[model samples]
Target: MKINVVKGTRDLGPKETARFQEIIDKLDSISYFYCFTEVTLPIIEHAQLYKRSVGETSDIVRKEMYAFEDKGKRLLVLRPEFTASIVRTFVNNKIHALIDLPFKVHYHGPIFRYERPQAGRYRQFYQYGVESIGVNSPLIDAEVITYGYAALSFIGIENVILKINTLGDDDSRNKYREIISEYFQKHIHKMCHDCNERLQTNPLRILDCKIPSDQEIIKKAPKIHDYLSLASRERFNEVTKLLDQSDIPFEIDQTLVRGLDYYSEIVFEYHYYSDEGKTLGALGAGGHYSHLVKELGGPDLPGVGLSFGVDRLVEVLKEIEEDDNEEDYNSFVLFYLIPVGDVKIEDVYDVLMELRKQGGYSYDMYHEKKPLKTLIQKAKKRDARFLIFIGEDELKNNTLTIKNMKTEEQMVVNRQDAKQVIRSLFFSSMREG
Candidate 1:
């Protein structure tokens, strides 16, 4: 019987693995330069942690979460989001006192969701994100946005429009919720089940409904800008002022209410527009989830953050055929040893390893290990940079013939010197900028 891997997930082969690693490594390097330290949290977090902070009515907590009971009957969930876990870690460990204010951190890991798989959406996806804790200033929100922009730029994803909005403070949102709840009351029967439930508990969510009818209806409805209090409006202005001074382009979008609950003041999403002039879904996005602190039993410290779907970002890279540049990847040299039938294969194996041990060149010819011509073809298939021949003739001369695969140049070097010579050459080839 053949058992296949689960759907909505994929295995990254060698080339694909390199592509994904390059994206993360570039982001990590750039974020570190900005003084954002790296932090990690467990994949499984307490179920109540999300339920209490992300709001019971939010889609992330109400449905699509992978929740189960462990041996002790303790409820746990595969983390669907990051802000809650990061906050929980900050409070439990007392990170604020140990670190200075504006505790900035970046995280990269897999996040779980039970939603249907799509072209770019998956049940198991990866995210690379940064969070700033213990700061309520609008400048913190602006700085997080700048970090996110720099990260995407570092990864060659620059053609994205930054759509930003504000949830306003508690005092500003109450009246807007009242207006939306009353309007939805009359049209409750017209919305999808999720929107109907969202109407009663979180009228703001109605703006995010995917249904065409709901989208059309909400367009004419009250805008969040019209209801924002004077102080909240000034804070939004301050965030944009910083963005303007930093030279990052942005557009005001009142309908950008995120799916999470604890977001307030400033929220944003990065929408990538293809060269063909269409929004190619979200490449990477994040926002200020400030109010989730006190809800998670921590101080009323505010925070701002952003996370990009690694799976979706990878898809965009593939769609544009950007990874085709052969020069961008590192080249590893390889040697193929063809064991003549009469020669003891053990000696060939021992010598080949000696070349690899003291020398750093990589090589393999596990299959079709026959004549020189066949072995050379195999080396080309593996993209080997250099090829070596070990046969009856080389054993007698105490010498080895190495050929540069690209230039087809051949050199005969002493057996002992080959190790030291190749070690220096290989290390120089792998040097970074």
Candidate 2:
């Protein structure tokens, strides 16, 4: 068999990779505006970490986790989601004990899934996520949702819809799970395999079933908000009030149970129209899971957060790329130095080093070993804006010839003055991020 990339993976060259970076960068910028510093958790953790936190019965841990045993026979798993790992970090480090109130932070990196690949879905993908822990206030829940919307909007994902729902508080959710299992007890055989599994494992997840028959039946089942305890209902109302004051539009989607079972109290999803803004799919999603910190062995503090599907976001951007018929906006100013012969190559090398030392220029193929005409053509192909000719005449006179590729204007200057000319084109350190 011929060698190639793995089945559900992709090799992103410069252009595609840059696009990916830009999207992530924009998200980080938006997140920073909302007081989210960055945090990094490991890719692999003990298998029990996810099993306990995300629930062993949920599709993520049950069917999708890429779990294996290390040399020590310890069960290790590539993280399927960020929240579990984030909480594990917080608990392990006793971060809650150190920080005051809500510990706001964000994470950005690859996430693994073993599901069959399709449009807007990939086996190996990336998630740029944020998590706020330690606070159980309703405003914190609303803050989590609104900040997610802000990240998407900052990236120009205009067609996103905010789907809001509550899983009741921790206590009320246990009751709702019980009611659903009892209500759908006899209908098990008629339900889809996933639903049947979810029924026993996480009954609330059954409400998210895609089976046409079961969906109709599940819709009439009990709404989770009805079961919310006094504290739970009041917390949900406070979250809604903050959302209203912030003027972020949302819809109450009772059936919007997350794939993982850790979410509680307040939950929501940000759905976006894919490809040419047509059908709906999740570009990003997140919500509150108040009990996760406690379950992960942390203090009795609540947590809430969201993560964006970078693969889907890229897929949507690809559609826009094709529609606009444009590639990445990359402008490379190739500085080509003309060389007369190998004898003068050392001088050209020195010039290249000097340009790089100035901190804003990149040059290639300018040695005297390469012909001047050949290097000039290479620079042209790269859309170079400035052509610097360093040849035998310049070496003797100690002058430099600078050609502006844009205006085709040529100027001859002393060696020191040439540095000043190039410096004017690129900004200094103060202007950089």
Candidate 3:
């Protein structure tokens, strides 16, 4: 019987795996530079964690969550997002009392959501994000946005527009919700079924509806900014001002209420576009949550964070690299050992081990006895920089033949001097650079 991968999931082959690692490494480096320590959270948590923190009215809890009952009669769910789980970790561990005032942590892993798979999206996807807990200042919010922006820029995703909005404080949101609910009630028949349901549960969610027919009605609905309380508006202003001072370009999108319900105050998304001006939607997004920590049974501490869709970012990187004709440096082989006519594995095993042990180098050997032409083709296929051949002649003369794949220059060197010769040839230009 033939079996296949589950729908909406994929196995990342070597090239994709390499690209994922490269992107993750770059983001991890940047996170460390910003003094954000790494944290790993479990993939499964009590189902109520998301339902309570992410909101039962939200789509994730209402529709997208992958929930199941364990054998122990316990309801569990594969985490749909990181923020709530991270907050739960903080609250459960009493991290606030254990660590500094604001606990900054970064994390990366696969998150499960049972949604329709689309381009750059999947039922199972990866995310990298940072959360700064126990901080309420708008300055921290701005810094988080800047950090996300800087990370995307570092990953070669520069053509992004930062779309920001404010959900305002509790009072502001409550007032607007009532007003919007009343307005939508009058035109609810014209909107989608989900919008109609959202109007009854969380009216703000109507603004996030994607149906073309509902958009006309949503567009005419109230904007959150007009209803924002003085304090909420001032907080939004401070965040924008900080961003301006930092020279990070952004747009005030009044309709951009993030999908999660816990988000309040300032929220933002980094939207990427193609060279021809086609939008690829949000590559990453996050917002300030005023009550998430307290709601999760922790102190009434505020937090801010953002997360990037790793799968989407990898796709974007592939596009950019393709457009620029970039080389796959991650796959470039430093040395390829070829065994020619009547060459035994034992004859070149020492040299292979030596090259492998050397720092800042990668080496692979053609173990099977193949013709010289076939060996050369294999080396080329591996994108090898240098091809080292060991055969009867080399075994007898105690020498090695090395050929520069790019320059096609060949030279024989004493077996003991091979390492030095290869380093001098490869590192000369790298050192200069």
Candidate 4:
């Protein structure tokens, strides 16, 4: 019997992992320039934590959470999202007290949900995000969105666009909710079940419904900006002003209401388009939360953050990869070491270690029984740039033979000086290229 893997999940082979890491590295590098430090967060947390911050009415908490009761009869869950967990860590650790104000930190990890998966959506997926806490300035909001856009651009994603909006603070949202709710009530019976449920729970979420039939009713719903207070309006205006000054293109999407309860004021999404201009969906999203920190038992510090769905972004990258006919950017082993006649595998391993220590891309053939021709062919198939043969003759003579597979050029160097010679050759090759 074949044991099938879990639905809504798939394994990432070496090629995928390499591409994932490349995107991650670029994100980290760009975040560092923006002064955001890295923070590691737990994959599991108390189920109540999300219920508090993510809103009990949100789809993620109400339906998608992978929740269970542990042996201690305590409810735990594999996190469906990172924002609440990060906030919980900050509160529980008293990170505010230890760190300076306006603390910025980034995180990358897997998140689990029980939703029906599809292309670019998974039950177990990865997310990378950064949180800027302890401030409420609109500039910070602009900074978060800018970083989100920059990250997608850095990964070679093309034709990306930013959609931003404001949900206002509690007072504005409360008033706007009342208006939209009453409007939806008139047409409630004709809408989908989800929107009907949302009309009673969180009316703002109804605006985000994707049901084709509900969208027309959603479009007629009261806009949030009409209810925005003077301060809230100016706050959103300032965020747009900053993005404008930075020359970052964006549109004010009045209907953009994040699925989380904590998100207030400014919210945004990075939408990606393929080279052929096909919309790939939301590649990244985030917003500001004014009450989350205080509600989570931390200081009354306002925060803003954004998260990139690594899985979706990977899909986008794969599409671009095929379109551009790009070769794998990950390292292809530069050389393969083969142990020949009467030479122990250890001999080849020693040279392999030295080559690696000097930052040379290399691997070793352990079984000496394989013919030299076969080993060379294996190396060629792997796209290895060179083959180093450790034979009894070379071992006795204390010399190494390095052959450039592509050019069919061979050279001999004293074993004691092999590392330096290889380093010089590698560096020279890089410079010439």
Question: Which candidate number would show the highest lDDT if scored against the true structure?
Answer: 3
**TM-score of each candidate?**
0.92, 0.91, 0.93, 0.94
Ranking by TM-score: 4, 3, 1, 2
Q: Rate the local accuracy (lDDT) of all candidates.
A: 0.80, 0.79, 0.88, 0.86
Which lDDT tens digits does candidate 2 get at residues 1-433?
A: 9899887777776567777899989998988899998998889888898888888787887788899999999999887888988888888888867878688999898888889888767778889989998877777888889998888788877777898888887689888888878988877888898887777677777888877998888878878887889988888788888988998888889899888878776778888775455843777788887678888887788888998888788777777556453454444654667666554677788877776776657765443465667877867877676787877788889887877776677888887776677675334222431
**Please, what are the lDDT tens digits per residue for candidate 1 over residues 178-240?**
977887788878779888788878989988887898788877777888898999999999999
User: Candidate 4 regions off by >4 Å?
Assistant: 323-331, 342-361, 366-368, 431-433
Stronger candidate by TM-score (1 vs 3): 3
- In the range 319-425, model 4's lDDT, one tens digit per residue, is 87774534454446776787777777777777677767766446555455677778777777677776788888887898888887756788989977987888776
RMSD of each: 3.1, 3.2, 2.5, 2.3
Ten-residue region with minimum lDDT total, candidate 4 = 323-332
lDDT of 3 at 370: 76
Give the Cα error of residue 86 in candidate 1, in Å. 1.4
In the range 312-336, model 3's lDDT, one tens digit per residue, is 9988877877744344434557788
How does candidate 4 fare on TM-score?
Answer: 0.94
